[model samples]
Target chain A: MGKRRTGTPTLEEVAAHAGVGRGTVSRVINNAAGVKESTRRTVQQAIEELGYVPNLAARSLAGRRADAVALVLTEPDWRQFAEPFFSEIVRSLGDALVDTGMQLLLTLVRSEGERQRFLEYARGGRVDGILLISVHAGDRLPDMLAEARLPTVLLGRRSGDEYVSYVDADNAGGARTAVAHLLERGRKTIATITGPLDMYAAQSRLRGYQDALALAGLRGTRSLVAEGDFTEESGRRAMAELLERHPEIDGVLAASDTTAVGALHALRAAGRRVPEDVAVIGFDDFPLAQSTKPRLTTVRQPLEEIGRAMVRLLIEEMEEPAVAWRHVILRTELVVRESS
Target chain B: MGKRRTGTPTLEEVAAHAGVGRGTVSRVINNAAGVKESTRRTVQQAIEELGYVPNLAARSLAGRRADAVALVLTEPDWRQFAEPFFSEIVRSLGDALVDTGMQLLLTLVRSEGERQRFLEYARGGRVDGILLISVHAGDRLPDMLAEARLPTVLLGRRSGDEYVSYVDADNAGGARTAVAHLLERGRKTIATITGPLDMYAAQSRLRGYQDALALAGLRGTRSLVAEGDFTEESGRRAMAELLERHPEIDGVLAASDTTAVGALHALRAAGRRVPEDVAVIGFDDFPLAQSTKPRLTTVRQPLEEIGRAMVRLLIEEMEEPAVAWRHVILRTELVVRESS
Candidate 1:
């Protein structure tokens, strides 16, 4: 508790206060597991009492890692910012990083200028690795990071031939399972509301729907498939269009739960009873799925598992830069409720 | 782009590629405003082509700022993590920091040990400032930060007499306005579902309800108040308890929109008509407020404005450390809808 001669208390002062060597205090500060529990406690107490603040910049300059990871959001649309998917993934990522002693730096790169700025920031050794989410097709940020030899992991792939490290859900397989379930329930005429075709996940989902129909020896007509942007309004519009073209449609699969909610609204407006008139299934089984009227039967993506996998891959790449890029796709489950 | 003989491309190579001086390249890399648009483009192309990455560690060691901010979440409850409030605030903060070239480092400090770890991380000079959210009353992290001389800003106060810099919405005023609105609608016996009183925001909201009733020459009875923890389940339990205690209650004020949704569910279960039998008002006009059966009337906190203010104050403090800590309180507005 003595007044420091300098501006802030040093490691030496903490060691002196605890009657230990400076190296012991350093070991404790670094959270080295080799230190004895009792000695670590005494050093921690002295450090807390003395208000010792370690200089990370100096330590990093001395060849220690920055011990931080950057979680970059590459999507520019503000509407996606409000989606439950984003928050869920972020929370899961935070949970995965809880014990790693590595902080998550959230950055939004909207334009080319901002992307360049982020590259420089990452290259400057501020972060040990990067986790990217919502990256669009043809976005060169991933390739740039790869060329720069920075360790990076992406939430989803840009294409089936994506060379960068990524963790993706079984979007196609989930959609196929939903369609198969609807088929098993004696629904003859089926329709689908797909997400935007430009994205790989959406394309994969559309493919799944087609594959399921083909496997059942049925051809999916063009009129029965409508494109949506994964928003509620888009879903409503697509659903209305499908109903208009084929009023006998007995089954519908939406690319996302939000879209499914919109579809439900449209169906209600048309006085169609859920399951009795139109069996509906949604993807991403968000919390809203359980609260909707009739309760949506949807496909639940293993989002937490995806987040953990992303972190694991990024850490591996950071620790061993020569490691090959990895692509991990986690399985999805069909959650049955009242809607189906 | 010349072939690099050593490790990665250097700044000098980028300057040579751009046909500019090293200082000019540095200026462009730092995003200095002095560079012409055309010159900036040329320098940028060179940097991109050469894949030159600046050493931020060296730059920071030479007295340059890290140009990064740390956003610390002190709340440990996983349920709260799923709330829309957290995502909205984070998006707003990201928007505010867009043009500043400052990255947001998100750190969750759940335990005292993690709090100490965060302090070391912040003090290590990885971030230029810190923004704290979901801090509970009597938490000493703020004081510890102050003693460490770190430029920090809190989303809400720890207490009424908090000395740290903070930006908060008028929770009490918002609640008062909501209660007043219910009374103006000729609600005779008003009850309230309160959030957890351990938090300052919840306490202020409860006081606001009492103040509004007292101002109207009516005493708030102890039997009319039920405690909730801002969760939908808590709201439902509290509302059911309140109805049992006072079945003749004609109006109710909920601490949050989530709580109000629960109240609405309980009223429906009891066969009570919305505006005709029991009018209800909620705080925090979340998107869910609009999707409710009766479309809840609620108080709208200026969350985006609060976020912008926090960033502004932190940047100011970072620039001028000697500036006195400022407390900012933004006004809230009531959005009238169908429920009340």
Candidate 2:
């Protein structure tokens, strides 16, 4: 880690690094009306090199800084914000911005039009920085923001090779641990519930499940798999469908705790005893894990830590653009509980 | 109801409605940094008369509009955001902002210093508007913001009348219904779990609980009453404490589902059969309500609607500054399930 600057580095250092006119550096750094990007980049490069962290406290005193940061969540489902997974991140992000004495702007870009508007707000300097989360397939928000040279950090990684700073959990490895636990239990007829396939997290979890089954020489039967949108209702219905298709299945692994909770309900309704007739496990050991009957053995995503990590990465990127883009994969743990 | 504008309205209309000059209207609306109160009021009157709304979109074409809004929640507990109450509001707030083509920024503040910094950002025009949720006692945030005359609205009522707009549910009525349900079940040894006494919601819920007991002519046992922080663990612990204090207690009305779920766990662990040994009811019909074993009979807070209402109130407050501040109290309903 680089030593923290005593104060924002001098404009002279910025000018020296950018290799531009002192006047040009002043114009760009000040965001003075007529500076071009070529000039802006020179100034940005100079600022970046000189460790010129915009002092929000001093800036607030002057009321000259943009004084705001925009949080761009590219959610395919708008309501997922109600889900604890997303809310935790927002809370942390908000807390971090408060420390900087910066206003936080949250945007949900569900459609292409929303994304365009978001770009306008972000690029127009309405926000000094951007934080992106839950990017889906064909989502171009991250790329656009990065290409525009906006300081951005993502909550999760994008699949593309482009260098982007992000913080994510080891989803595939976590799923494998979950499935392997069921395998070692001698539960032969195990089924799985997957999240939306378009999402990489979902895709990775599914892949891990498949890899585990292949290693055990178990058939990846279509009947043993069902997809859910990570809600308990969907989990219950999926479990029901899985039971109907493969009545002899003895174990289940769900993508989330809420889903697993639903599965438990379905199993109880079907007169199946947990860990006796059907052992069940879930991911993201939410508070509901303990709340559920027999409790739930699930994968702990370290979501709060993930939130903290994302903020840290975003702060790093904001402070040093030349800093290497990072993929900080937090480790996941398997917590054994009554059900599994 | 007023018609939503398709685009920006004429400046003349704003000036006429505000009963001020075109120059004054231009200065205030454009945020040109200097305008007297009387002149600004006249301009605002003219604009209101002309049915004018500032053309942020048009201004953004010049790359100058700050299209982001801030949702500042004065909550310290991390678990509070984990609860469905805050998440639901955040989701609805996101939806409402999306519809209006504004970005939402979320921030958490607990201390006086943090509050001051947050207000500084808002006053600096970092965000187009502000949404404040003050959960704890003696939170002067709403009053401070309102006094600063920032475009602001509260999620719940403040201690004193401050001419600020707000949206809240009928918490007292909801709690009353919950307790009443307990009495109807023929459970005479009724007990209740109250939320934090410092909060108005908690106080109101307690009032409702008392109201039901009073109407039923049943003794409100001091030993049977417990207080929880609206968490499952707190609920569980409170239930255990209640049982230890009053082993003969046969009915319970918990302040939140999380606490109720905890109570359920405690009851089952203590070898007490639910409904047969003791009846349980909780508030906030979160997903946990239905997921609970025997299902938790709870009071539905219309969480999403409350969130939507908060956004609507905040938006209206921004649109019409002198409009009568509204205190919206949406109704709650009792959801009967197996628990009681």
Candidate 3:
């Protein structure tokens, strides 16, 4: 083997070792798209062999001096701000960004003027990228940001036809597993409380619940479904509405843990014992799930992983404008507790 | 009265009417400090008469290109991130900034490298100002940023000798009220569980506990005290220790709602009935306070208002470097619930 150089390896040396032009090495290092996969692999290998570390400061200076990304939450209801899911995702995102040297700018746009100002600021090249969460259907901000070429990533899609990159938990699969668990427990009358149908996640989860029942040779009718806005109060009201219509629900699949908590309260008020009279399962397995009486059985999504994946995707998109629009859906685990 | 202008009033018109230099008019219009109160009022009256509105875009371009502020949290513990307090404050701050057209960048620094990088970023003029929260004693970041002439406002101070502008809740007064309530209930042996000593809020709460006892002619020794880290688990552990050492303790004051929940759990595990057996009071009336079994009586601090005030103070400092340093302490209310 040749004697190892004492100083940091230069781009020219890496290119020479990989037998490529200096520009090719630069593009590969910067994660620019359009390079052949094999060539990219070769350049990566050369970089690994030489241990070439890109100077982040120099790269940021050459690009834009602002080393910041915006984490925008588009929820109009401020009540949702208290959800444990928000804090969990934010903490995970902060942890993921610790090593990237990029700050997370948290902007909540509840008004049209604020929204317009944010879009203008983002488009003006003040922020390197954006990570938008809690987007509702028919929201134009995501499309506008993407159209402006502002390197945007959504936490979840507005619908199936989302054009921007996003990382989401497998909501449908989680709901399916929740219903299947209830079915295995010999629950004949299964009902579901869904989040607002305007969100794709809620719609997907409702679909999964229906699919699970159908797969089990059970019939799920419209009477067994109630709509919720994912708040505990809504869950309680929906549960109340369901009971008034069909009081024989032996099992329930709530779209979120907060809703499940409300369902638990409503069942207690109705003189029903958990798991014995009505088995209930929730999604998102937040801390409240464990704290709830009888300990709610819920589907645990990899929130931290989702956050890390979002940062990774946003970083990739920012580095290479040509990177394909990617959609990532992580799996969920069913944590069986006494509530189920 | 002068005839109403057909279009937007010019800065020159306001300056001429105010009978001051154009620079002085600009300073007053922008809310910049260092001008006498009388002169400032005169300029403001002139601007109001002319109905002049400074162009934000022009002001941003003429001043610093960046119109963003950093909200820094000093805690290295990720568990603290899940606290409801973080979400509430963040949402409120976002709401306050909605009309300002400025963005909030959240930077969580866990490691030394991340902390150094963030300090350098702020000192390098990448952001216009900073709002710091959860500050611990001897933390150098706030001092460093303030010394570097960056406009800084802290949610709570590191200690009583803090020189920076800050907005705090009446922690000591709240704790005293809690103890007084316990005294009114005829509980003699009142014990206190404190948050981390490094935090000013925690220390003030402890002081309040002692002062209340002293005022009531009840001796409060170190044996009646146990330390917590403002976490549920810490509260549980502290409650367990207090019970072991002073089984006769009849009243408990927890520094935070989360800690109170843990204390309640510990009391239950030990077969102690809430209120009837061992009365408990918690600080920060979070949602968890109401959800806890038998409910938790807590001190309700104006958390949202504190957030808004922090933003307001930071904006003032940013607009006027010579603004006098101000400290604000909002009052807390004693919320009676089943726990007490």
lDDT of each: 0.88, 0.76, 0.85
For residues B1-340, what per-residue lDDT tens digits would candidate 1 score against the true structure?
A: 7864743567888999999999899999778788889999999999888767777776775664677898888877756765677777888897898778787767777778778878877777778899999888978999898887899999989888888999999999998999998888899999999988878899899999999999999999999999998988899999999999999999999999999999999998888999889999998888889999899999998888998999999988898874698889999999999998
Q: What is the DockQ of each candidate?
A: 0.42, 0.14, 0.14
lDDT of 3 by residue, B1-340 (tens): 7986433456788889999988999888667889999999999999888757554334443564357788887778756776678877887887787677677777776667777778766654557889998888978888777766778999989888788999999999999999999999999899999999988999999999999999999888999999999888899999999999999989999999999989998999899999899999999998778888888999998888998899889888887864578789999999999988
Considering summed lDDT, which 10 consecutive residues are worst modelled in model 2 chain B? B56-65
**Weakest lDDT window of 10 consecutive positions for candidate 3 chain A:** A53-62
Q: Which one wins by TM-score: 2 or 3?
A: 3
Top candidate on TM-score is 1
**Each model's Cα RMSD:** 5.2, 12.2, 11.6
lDDT of 2 by residue, B7-88 (tens): 3356656665666656777788756768877776666566556545444333433332346678887777665765667666
Interface RMSD of each: 2.9, 7.7, 7.4
> What DockQ score does model 2 reach against the true complex?
0.14
Worst 10 residues of 3 chain B by lDDT: B56-65
lDDT of 1 by residue, A1-340 (tens): 8854744677788999999999999999877778899999999999889878776676676664678888998877656655677777888897898789787767778778779888878888888899999888879999999987899999989999998999999999999999999999989999999987878889899999999999999999999999998888899999999999999999999999999999999999899999899999999988889999999999999888988999999888987884698899999999999999
| Best-matching candidate per DockQ | 1
Name the candidate that leads on lDDT.
1
Q: How well is candidate 3 docked (DockQ)?
A: 0.14
* Alpha-carbon shift of residue A288 in model 1 (angstroms): 6.9
